[model samples]
Target: MKEDAVDGDPFTTRDVGVAYHAYSASGDVTAPVVYAGSGNPSDYDWLTKQGIDVKGKIVLVRYSVPYSYRGFKALAAEQRGAAGILIYSDPAEDGFKKGRTYPDGPWGPESHIQRGGIGYDFRVPGDPLTPGWASVPGAPRIKAADAASLPKIMSAPLSWRDARPILEALKGPDAPATWQGGLPITYRVGAGPATVHMRVQMDDKVRPIWTVTGRLTGTQSPDQLVIVGNHRDAWVYGGVDPSSGTASLMELARSLGALAKRGTRPKRTIVFASWDAEEFTLTSSTEWGEQHARDLAEHAVAYLNVDSSTSGPDFKASAVPSLNRLVVQSARDILDIEEGTPEMLSNRLGGGSDYTVFLNFLGVPIVDMSFSGPYGVYHSMYDNHRWMQKFGDPGFVRHTAMTRLWGVMALRLANGDVVPLDYRASADRFREFIKEAVQTARLADLPALRPLKAAADRFAIAADRAGLRIETLLAGDPPDPAAAALIDRVLIGTERAFLDSAGIPGRPWYRHLIYAPKATYAPEVLPGVTEALEARDRKQIALQVARLAAALDRAAAILDGSR
Candidate 1:
């Protein structure tokens, strides 16, 4: 390495490194390294003003500050004609800046690296070659080059320690004040002073993924299903990721078996799934969902997904709006060791986990949860049993509490006469979604929005009537089986009613009109409308609005028993 290569920035090269990020193009290149701040569009806009271009350069970007995923950063760089991207974690985002360092506290050490896939799973998850179908043996497939979710540029992960020299080598304008990282050097947006060699080789191959599914057939309605799921795969050992959730699920399953042995069974079937290859591309669950699409559409009552069940003690959850009350009840039922109340339920379901296919693609009601906190060693080797025992979950009391909550929630869904789905929350959320969509688009005169609002209002009315009927049944003697079945049938169709076979515009595989990731970690509200707004096309926006209104009216009709 030349002295001028780093501009005398002192950094010790270490042996610690991660696998080339998934989907990163295999490459060997030596090119000038450019700092693109966080690689967000705004940063690119600033670079344009300084007459800096990233084409054919390897762009250095920090892990999200305002919180965009690494895949988004890579996509942004590739779109700018950058040959490759290196995403490093700054202490300010995930290390010493947050709290004490590892060994003393839960934050990451200087050498920690985050390993993740860089696929545009937000566009379409599962096997990229088989977009709308299962990846079973001999299944129909498409060329990898044509896969929408595949990335075309090289990408890798870096720790701040490894990145300091390159950043210091930059001889350009100081970065925006907000772009300054925790490293001591003056942060600069550089397209010069640093030239480096980078090589990545990956065995990009198609393989089979397995999803292990088990069922406890119901004593009564065996067709109506309550599903519980957790990913079995991990980036590393994944102690605090799926391991915690898996252990809890195993205990829950064991308890369910014990109950069944004692002749006690749920009124509706309970299905437990251990999904494989979630860390790869959300593979197994997505494929399974595609394989059993018709059965799931007809039978799946609700889905409960647990990922990293107890990283700390802060309980957080995301759910479809209709499941709001049920989730709230479960949260209230669980007695956390720390007595921390669950955070407000976020209705947006992100595509980062196994729940994506069920909630977004299949239009099944879903709730995803975790007991998360600031351990900071996420996706690294340090995210292991020692960390979980010492910091993530001392004594594993939180883990036990999670199992209790999960079992209770699943039992409630399975034992309830009418599946316990309350649509008032859905109505309220739809009303709010329309207002937000209108405000987001800044189209006060959008005609489709008016019809959308009308549908929401009617849905609310129907929801209120159904709520009254449910209350009456619960207060009096046990309702007749025929009456309960009628209401349950209608409620089952509520989520399915939101599906549009055309999907959110171009991404037809994501059939749910109501929810999708929309190209980020967290799910966005009114994904179709949001997609149109992102495209800045008024015609598409109007078309999306009309479609959404129709879906809402259809849901309203189901709730009103007029479907």
Candidate 2:
């Protein structure tokens, strides 16, 4: 390493090393550097437009986008013959631009480097070798080298402080306006005067990870399952990410345990899970879900997940629309500790948590909630209890509130005679998604969107009619056991109808048609349709649109009690 004229250290420290999926071989090679902003697919497109060839260069990208996108960037770079990759967090996204630096405020300081996996979570999100199966003690595994989601090129995280010299030394065309960061120097798309030497090494071994599961059997309906889970592992202190959620989970367990001791229990069985290794692509949860796939699919009512429980005062929830009503009802029942009043939980939808397996893979309805406020210290040592006390939850009241809300929601689902699923809401949400997808597809001039639009309309009508029947049933006297069981089965089966046994095009592990991560590393409503359109693959577009339409039609039939 050469000493730069810069005052501070020009190399990332060993303490905050790079993340998973980084190539695990050591070799020294120096090459010219190129600045690739955010490292999103569009950013690569921009580089191509600028006539910049990253081939034989070591690309410098920002850690502003999702981890999966980082992997996409690496794959793109490798395809273009790039030698290596270095990722840094720009102040515009996580540093002083958000607020005062760490030690002064919650934002990251100059040397704060965000470490995370570059694994292709959109393709599959468990142990790489296991893929679609659980990584159990005797589970058959594939060779590590043959894993489809692993990166081929070396990658590392560089603190902005360490990146200053390299960025300043770059010689190329001025970067586009959107490519500029909060750094003081002018951003550039370089094939540079600056060169970087990169290396990476990792241990290839299979290790045991424990998933702590505790169950309380229901006296009346022991077969019905209500599961609530939060991951217990972290890369660092994890105060705002998993620790906060972990604490809330413990509190909920304590409260529930007390009720059970007093002989007051939920009508449906409850399972409390503290999953391990979620940070490495949702490992424990996915494995456990897969291992228990049969029983879960038959009995599980819903999965409620909480990660990064409270980072701020605003209540937010992401869920399949069938569970939206329960989320709303729960939020309305609990007092927002910050505001001293009840407020509606903001609706959000996407992936990046423990709920992925249950909702996207197993087709179980799920609701994930959090209270987020300026979170800049993610995946860093700075995310400690001290930081959480100062910026996340000052009095810990929000944690209690979250626990109470979770309990209420779980209890409501467990004890209700009728499963509280709202097909009308699901239909309405699907309609909205169709409109949005159609508009975006049209803008992209995609010819395959017509089928999706037509299918969504048909599903909407079916869903409305089904919803009316459910309402009529609920409004009358308590249904007989047979009728109640039929309604419950239909409600549970609706999500399952969306699953395609063959799974998505390239990622066989993710089977759901309604929800799956797109290539951009964000969750899409009709993932099959959106991903095919994004790839500009005419054949896939037609194929996925038909699959998505069929899934919706199946869901409608289930909800209408035809299946």
Candidate 3:
């Protein structure tokens, strides 16, 4: 890899570096560059509308979009006949436009490059060679060349400073206003005079990675499980990414250990997991989940994930609706370290972390939380303890707060007689999703969504009645273990109802009907409906819609104790 000189001097070790996609095949090529804004699906469509052909070119895209969406961009570029892909972080989103540059503030500097894996994770996330199964000792393996999720072309991350010369040399029409970034040069969609060479050399071989697990057995319901996890790997130092979460997990384990020493063990089994290779492709956790699928499906109650636990002070969370009430209650109980007030957790759903396997594949109710502020030095060399102490959490208060929140939530889930899942809230959330899906589908002239709306309404009624019955039972004297057990069965089975054993179209690994990660602007419920509609496959749209309705019906029947 080569980069332009800066300040009449070539790049030193501090300024010159590259981050490549995992499993990127070794290659050497030189081609003209094309600027595709954000490299989203719509952005590609925009490039088409502007009559710019990226075929046989080196594509340049900004890293403003979600990490889950980055691979889609690379795949899209490959399909369009691109020779290679270069990704960079624009100052508009994470640098000077947001705040001061790094060395002065928390934002990224021109030399701070964001590096990450470029696997097409929305299809399947794990070791590329071992899909749909655990990568265990002597496991059945496939050839690395046959792994469909790996990138078909070379790809790397570039610092914006290194990218400026190539971008400025391009000759093309001015980009749409929104396509313009915070760079000083005039942005253009390029097929350029800026030809450049690219190469990615990687050793494709299986290696050993460890997932550290610590278990505390329950006193009464030893079979019921509550798991907490954070990945241990990083692109570089990872101070604000996994390391922050890793520190919080360590603190949580210590706290829980102290509590256990005082004879306060949880009522249900609690597991603490520090996963490895998550930055590469969610390898360790996914493999572990696959290895223990049967046990987890039967015994696991919930999974709480803390990735990048604190970059700031605001409390943010993403979870399945059944866990919403528990998360809110937990947040309200913990005071924010910076604000000195009860934290208010905000909910959204999108996948880019270790929660994928537990939530999407296993149907285990999961929640991921972080106390995030302005974190711009993501995946860069600058994300070290020095940066963390100076800009991220000076007093480590946010880390302590995250530990408390995680420990308290795990304790509640493990010890509560009546599992704190709220199906009524799930129903309400489903209704919202159905309404939005219907609105979006109608705009696209899709009529297959009617049945989904009807099913959501039916499910809502059943969920409400079930919620009332559970509340009444909880209020009764000497909580009936049998009744509580029955409710627990229903709660656990509800998430499974959304699973389609055959999996989503094109992406068989993600079977959940409610949530699946995609390259969309916002998370969609019944994701297959939108995907099918996008493909203009009326038959597939109808099929997915009917299956979603059937799943909802199944959930309702289980909650009503009819199944």
Candidate 4:
């Protein structure tokens, strides 16, 4: 952990530093540090309206409610001409407000500083210099200055201990109720004498990253595949963040290897990968996904990701709706550590994992598995073995459960005669996404959503027809290989049809029209339409709705024909 402290705060050097990929201060930046609530654009806008401009001033923001990613906070501050940003965790967010803190319970200690990269990977993930393409041996590259995902302004993280002095020093208007944090001091929106020198210098360099892969070729069709992975890299010693999952991945690999030795291998190939640099930029996985884009598009059935396998005892999963049956089947087979009952699978996949590339970029069906609970030590040194053993995953029973669960999910896709992708749930979810966005944005008068709704309805009917056909084929005494192949193609095509080569309007690297990462790294369904609605740009909204409606129509037609 890099040490962090202010000139005025004379406590032990705090353990925090400027975030990865953020511009560092030239030397000591002695300036007035103003408080901006959550560092959101609206926060700055409010400051501007109140005649308190933030230009050339350092901003001290809390990691509080209305959860935008820290990178988004950095960008927001940069947008308003802030000289630098200091993001510190408020106890209400992930500290004693939750429960007893570290060394006592699962929450973070006063010293804990959440570490992470501030890169805008949601726009275009992977290597900044190699945006859309895979960065293999000699992949084409661009200057970091020209890269779309890189941050421009200086930034750093701070523990509340280090930030307390500065927050206490502020003199300004009382902050709104929502802007109050769990700190003892009263919150304020300031442009006062609370100025302090903020210094940062970084060693910005590109290092080699590796993605280790080993494929177990199938007996029936080696060309067909199922991919599974866990990211090996972590911000620190990521006990609950990734190492827990990494340990589970190793156990799963061993079990699978033993099965293969016994001459019981998957009918379709299983490619197991441990990706590097995932925590920083989600780099290695994205590169692998891009490098094999063509092959994956043609033959890949599903991707299973294991991340944070056990932080506590609540079993959870995130997946595309199309994989509901597969997830349900796998859950029924695995035992939950808490109740000793069948594990439960949660809802739609989010945007920040290795699966982002597979599902959003390559249109592969994906499921991300986890066992979560009070995980406040995320991205910190506190997330080490002791924390995991004492609080996260005591007895490591959950680890074994994860191993079995991960293997079972991968096997279901790899060994099944027919690709186990179903689109009925997907269609339902798509409609819900559209309706929620329209209602939330109150864009009921928007004209184009009518076609989008009709297209979604048609797609649902088509999905039912396709499901019926698959059921009959699976029930066949011996389904015709040619017919089964065609059905599988349609099933996979349903997912691929969601892709628009031009990508979500501004962020083309994220080609999936239905799902893409929001600027805050949250999963955005109907991303194109959702973003347009946020802008309240009717013409752009209409264009996005039409593009999505066309994709839905294309998916429906494929299902209709297969039936």
For candidate 2, give the lDDT of residue 418: 69
lDDT of 1 by residue, 230-265 (tens): 997876678898899999999999999999999999
Give me the displacement of residue 282 in model 4, in angstroms. Answer: 0.8
lDDT of 2 by residue, 1-563 (tens): 11112122222222443343433234467899999887766777788898998878888888763345566667767677778888887888888988997657888878776666666666788888888888898899998678876766777777788888988999788988988999999988888889877766666567899999998888777888999999989866688889999999999999999999999998889999999988777889999999999999988899999987898888878888888778876776685333223444433356678998998789898998888887777876677777777788999988988899999998898888867877778777787877787777745545667777677777778777777767777677775667777888888788888899999878788898877876555666777777777787778878888898898888877777722
lDDT of 3 by residue, 293-391 (tens): 999999899999998888887788888888877887787778533322334443346677888999889988999889888888888777777678878
Maximum-TM-score candidate: 1
TM-score of each: 0.94, 0.90, 0.93, 0.93
Local distance difference test values of all predictions, in order: 0.82, 0.78, 0.82, 0.81
Error of 2 at 526 (Å): 1.4
User: Which TM-score value belongs to model 1?
Assistant: 0.94
What would you estimate as the lDDT of candidate 1? 0.82
How does candidate 3 fare on TM-score?
A: 0.93
Q: How many pairs of residues collide in model 4?
A: 1
In terms of lDDT, model 4 sits at 0.81
Kindly list the per-residue Cα lDDT of model 4 for residues 419-447, writing each as its tens digit: 88889888888888878876777546456
User: Cα deviation in Å at residue 450, candidate 3?
Assistant: 3.1
Positional deviation of 437 in candidate 4, in angstroms? 3.9
